[model samples]
Target: MSTFLLEIGTEELPADFARLALPQLEQLVRRDLTEQRLSHGVVTTTSTPRRIALLVEGLPAAAADLEEERKGPPAGQAFKDGVPTPAAIGFAKRCGIAPEALELRDTPKGPFVFARVLERGRPTAAVLAEHIPQWIGALQGRRFMRWGEGESRFSRPVRWLVALLDATVISVTLQGSDPEVRAGNTSRGHRLLAESVTIPSAGAYAESLAAVGVQVDRAGRAAAIRSAVLEAAAALGARPDLPDDLFDELTDLVEAPLLIEGSVAEQSLGLPPEVLSTVMRAHQRYVPLYRSGAASDPLALDAKDALLPRFLCIGNGLPAASDTVRRGNERVLKARLADAEFFVQADRAVPSIDRRDQLARVTFAEGLGSLLDRVERIEWLTDVLLEQLQLGAATGDHARRAAHLCKHDLVSQMVGEFPELQGIIGGKYLLAEGEPRAVALAVLEHYLPRGAGDDLPSSDAGAVVALAERLELLLSIYAKGERPSGSSDPYALRRAGNGLLQILWERGWSLDLQALLRRATAHWSQLLPHFSVQAPALATELAEFLRQRLVSLLEEQGVDGDLVQAVAGEGVAIERVLSDPADARQRADLLAALRASGELAGVQAVVTRAARLAEKGSLDAARLSPAGVVDAALFEKPSEAAMLQVLEQLQPIAAGEGAARYGELARALAASRDTLAAFFDGDQSVMVMADEPAVRTNRLNLLGVLRNQASVLADFSRIAG
Candidate 1:
């Protein structure tokens, strides 16, 4: 066994591209190694901004030999009465064997000529050399470019290549590179701290690079950075705001981790913590330090109190240069914060209401009118949702006020400078202007759950406005005939739909989505006639789109696929699902609970059996009661009467709403297992399909009623046994 290493060095790559390329390179190497029959152990992939490296340990010196049977033309065509033909000669030549070496083999299709060929494996170094260029070419990332009259494309210009097997330099070349990169033992180190270093072997690559100020192990660099940040924050009695995304980017931004502490201007600390943090983290990639015990909650009303007038920058330079790096970062942050303060002062001079009027100049989308028009639509939808939700008059007033001012920040100087501060700045401005706290918070919370796993609005008013805003986006964009298909949701319509359902589920609000959509669609048809399709057709398309999103959301929440299908699948009526998503969510949960508790087996067995037999009857699924449909007088056995008794007990529970009712219905079905079994197979059992037409019809109706009641929970047949 031997170690193999391949490194692709380039001009400083984007942090995100370096992080993304590591896994791609690892996977490519693993797949190719497996295909080549070169078994290996512990494949490691790591990256710095300057290079991506792959190392494989315990690799076999050569791939295993392979023997395969090659099928050829049919025996009759290959050989004519014991004499070899042209087809036989050609087939053997292609197989690299003489015609006499071919043998006749019986196959399913017919007798065919076959050649058993054994291929000798090549040295592992040769295989790696051949695949090195292909692996580099197969890498994918955003904004890859060509450089210096070369046709090659990479995240950055390819400057050098390193390929080795044990201590031997493996021969490899990157085609089309202007510099004509080839494998060698020499590898470059930190741009500022060291020059090129000679690698002794594949196993010594990390040690060699580290000796020259380059940390080649990505995990080691990340761990050192995180530990240093936390320790530095601890020494200052502060907490570092190192989100995972920022941490990963920081790890890739530097080859050697060095923490440089920078100071924030006390005057700049007066800005909202969100603004300060955004400037430090998003713009400058510095980690903000907050007071130890100060709340880090994004929604905290007093979040500004937690922020400290300091930050930590991950510097790639040596410790001797720490003071210079810190001063540079502090100067940069000071200018950014000063610009933010200016934008805030300029924005707050005019009231939020004036900003609302300014929205008329900003187009929301083509053919959808201006931002002001969108605000008006949102206000109208808010009222509609408030009416449907019936959260009370005070909540209604707050929501309407919030909806009116939601887009006011879009035209604000502050938001113009920091697009992410849209709602945060608008709400802060409103609060400063003496608007009611409820109204201000609602404005802020309306953009809750900007993505999956994010927070949802805690206030009723915020929830209402949020729902209305998402609804308007879906309706208008869908009215323009745009739908999210596959990975092409440029408008993020799927996310909007998911957000709507998530808010409803989180708040436990029960609003009829189907009725709300139809109303919104009809209203859109009137308000924007140029983009209109028939209201009913558009409403249906929107509902199905949301339904698909709901299904995905439920499945992601760990609901069984069959149970999700039971409530929102194609088998379930769309009206039933959109009528109250909360109810459908509850039904799916109840079904999963029953399955987990070991009760679904019994209920499913009885319900599925009845459903299969119920197919023969013409009874309506809506008819839960056997009162008029079944003739108790036609019963031929005691089991039949007993089964009817159980059905009668389940009618009220099956006809009711919510999880409690469904749970009761499942219990009742499980309890009736014996009576159903007796009716199907016991001494008192009677044939469901009797010779007499009336008796058969009556028996089938009894089963049909049971099937209908069970379906109130789910289609049991869809469940796996």
Candidate 2:
């Protein structure tokens, strides 16, 4: 057995992309190796900000040998006069064997020519050399940079490639834009110190890099950065609000991790806390601090806390040696925050509402008109969703008001500077303008769950407004042919579509999705003059997209695929699925049970046949003959009368609700087992067929009705006995 090591050294990749892409790469490698029939190992995978690594231990030096069988045309067709013919010879050649290697075999389609061959195992190194390029090529990201244009696209340049089979560096070359590529025993370390280091084996890679100043473990690097920043803040008697995302991002930007404490200008403290925090984190990747003794003050940080600033940053090395770098970063952060503070104060003086008319200056999307126009379309659609939901008449006015003001903040200085803060700032502005809290939050949360597993709106009004906004974006963008492709979703349409479903599901309302969609899209039809792109008949297509999402959500919840096919087999009511008192697991069990009972199966078959015959409509009990009760003279045996009794007793009980109806009918059938056995033993088919046409039809109808009645509780045909 030998160990395997694969490393992909690349230029700095975006922190967020690295975090997601590396695990995917590891999984892909594991799957590929396993599929290749390489056994005997536990796979280990790891990622640093710059590279993704995989190590497999206990893997055999070569793949195991295996036997394979090949089939050809029938034996009768392949042989002529009891000797091998041209057809047989041709098959042998196709299988890479001589005629003598062929054999005869029996098959479902008479007999056929066959060949048994044993394949020899190849060295693991040979396999790795052949597969690595394809493996890397399969890796993708939201955005990839193509270096030198020779079909090489990665988040960054492929700086170094390390492939070791055991301790040997496998001989492999990558052909791409860079042209020259070779497997190597040496890899680079922290860019600041000992940038180039030799790695002897898979086991030595981590230690080799660490000794030269790089923390190859992303988690450790992150921990080191966080612990240092917090410790520095505690020493100053304050709290360090280290943003987790910013900390993660900074760790990836360097090979060696360093923790530094920096401060903003004292005069800048007058800005809103959120405004200041967003600017620092967004522009400078700094962790904000709160003075336990006093509010975070830039001057105090430069004074008593001078050694400890209002913001703490983790660079890639020691602060003493990087003084110029530290001071320079601080100056840049202060300037960004100063601009933020100025924007906030200026926007307040001209409040976003007063600037609403100015929204025409801002284009939400080129050719799609301005922010003001999108708001108008959204406002109109909001009314349609409200009407479909039959919300209080007051809701229409509120939705319109919320929609009109939702994008108002896009023009505000705070939002203009930081696009991520658009909805948040809008919400704040609404509250300040004396709008209701619900309306304000809707403005903010209508874009709730900007991504998967994110929060959703909690109020009905909020949900309604959210649905309207998302549908508008989806229709408008899809009309422009800007839909997400492969792994890229530039407009975040997938997230928006998902968020719309989540809000409806969480709200547990049975609003008619198709109707809501029709109304919403109809409103868009009128709003096209405001759009430059020909609206791509997207309203209907988008509705189907949402239905597909709902189906997926149901499947994930463990609903029976068949039941999902049956229930949602047609159009699904969003509300019914959300309101199912029995969770998905329970519904799955019920479906399984219904399809597992023998009596249920028999009953379903009979009922289905009867239903087809009486396709006109259901027959009333009055229409059924009282004299039609199994007559001993008309009945073939006691069993026929017994089945009748069971049917009559169950018909009414099965009309009731839930498991009780199912249980009671099952008991009724069980009770009549002996009689039904006698009736079938005597063969009642003769008597029923012997009756007059009307009488026979009535008898069959009675049997049909019995089958139909049993079907209500469960599909007997699906039951397995």
Off by over 4 Å in 2: 16-40, 59-154, 161-167, 173-181, 219-251, 259-273, 287-312, 319-329, 361-369, 384-397, 434-438, 474-497, 508-546, 571-721
Worst 10 residues of 2 by lDDT: 298-307
Model 2: pairs clashing at backbone N, Cα or C within 3 Å: 301-306, 598-721, 600-716, 601-716, 601-717, 639-679
For residues 370-393, write the lDDT of model 1, one tens digit per residue. 999999999999999988999988
Estimate the TM-score for candidate 1: 0.96
**Which residue window of length 10 is worst by lDDT in model 1?**
295-304
Reference-based lDDT, each prediction: 0.90, 0.68
